[model samples]
Target: MSELKIVDTGNELRLLGMDEASKLLGIQKSTLYDMTMRRAIPVVKIGRLNRFKLSDLEAFINQNRQEAQS
Candidate 1:
């Protein structure tokens, strides 16, 4: 069997586990899990584990950004 390795390109595109993702979003891990279950968030499935892309999460935040009323 061939072993798979992850190569870092020095970009902001790193896979984050549930704990890191939740902390980055400042939300509960359960909430992040729920979001993934509901397909409201982008996720990467590795076996039975859930992984998220830092860039994707940043995009989610950007897409959800709201401006103050003038």
Candidate 2:
């Protein structure tokens, strides 16, 4: 068996571009852009472009996750 390790960058977090963000979220770029326009997705404004933090995207996924409890 092999050991698994996660690399942490301390206070530095990686940011993703629109293309990468859309792919990670499994949505079309247009859809993501539309969501951003409506403030449905979390994003950061860099000049005139949109930027997404990987951590924020992860949180968004968790926030929208649905599970049934018995």
Candidate 3:
């Protein structure tokens, strides 16, 4: 029997760029930027760079889902 091993990239918890976050969320890049500018989504800024955490994105999605159902 062969066993499959999973490798952790460590990026799952790290910050993601706008494009990366958009891709992950399956949304348009422009929409993500607009949300960020409006403070409608969670994000972190490091100097001149904007970053989003995977955890924060997940939470945002969950919150949206709940809001839609309510």
Candidate 4:
């Protein structure tokens, strides 16, 4: 099997687990799942798991902020 890698998007970091991803967004896991179901957030799916990148999360936040400001 191939190894999973998370390269620097200008910063060193690894892929985030569901727990970390939810916490990063300051939302509960259930809420995260709800958002995913609503297609409000992007995710990386490996097999039956969900993963996220720090940069993508940041960009998501930025995009939401812009939308809210508009």
Q: For model 3, where is the 10-residue window of minimal lDDT?
A: 1-10
* lDDT head-to-head 1 vs 4, winner: 1
Q: After best superposition, candidate 1 residue 63: deviation in angstroms? A: 0.5
> Which candidate has the top score in TM-score?
1
Off by over 4 Å in 1: 1-13
Clashes of each: 0, 0, 0, 0
* Model 3 misplaced stretches (Cα beyond 4 Å): 1-13, 66-70
Q: Scored by Cα lDDT, where does model 3 land? A: 0.80
Candidate 3 TM-score, C-alpha based: 0.73
Relative to the unseen true structure, what is the C-alpha lDDT of residue 38 in candidate 2, on a scale of 0 to 100?
96
Please, what are the lDDT tens digits per residue for candidate 2 over residues 1-70? Answer: 2222323366447778999899988999999999999998889999999998877787777777776777
Kindly provide the TM-score of model 2 when superposed on the true structure, using C-alpha atoms.
Answer: 0.76
Candidates' C-alpha lDDT: 0.84, 0.81, 0.80, 0.76
Q: What are the RMSDs of all candidates, in order?
A: 10.1, 5.6, 7.7, 9.1
Cα error, candidate 4, residue 4 (Å):
27
Which pairs of residues have clashing backbones in candidate 1? none
For residues 1-70, could you state the per-residue lDDT of candidate 4 as single tens digits?
A: 2322434666445678889888878899998888877878888788988888787787787666532243
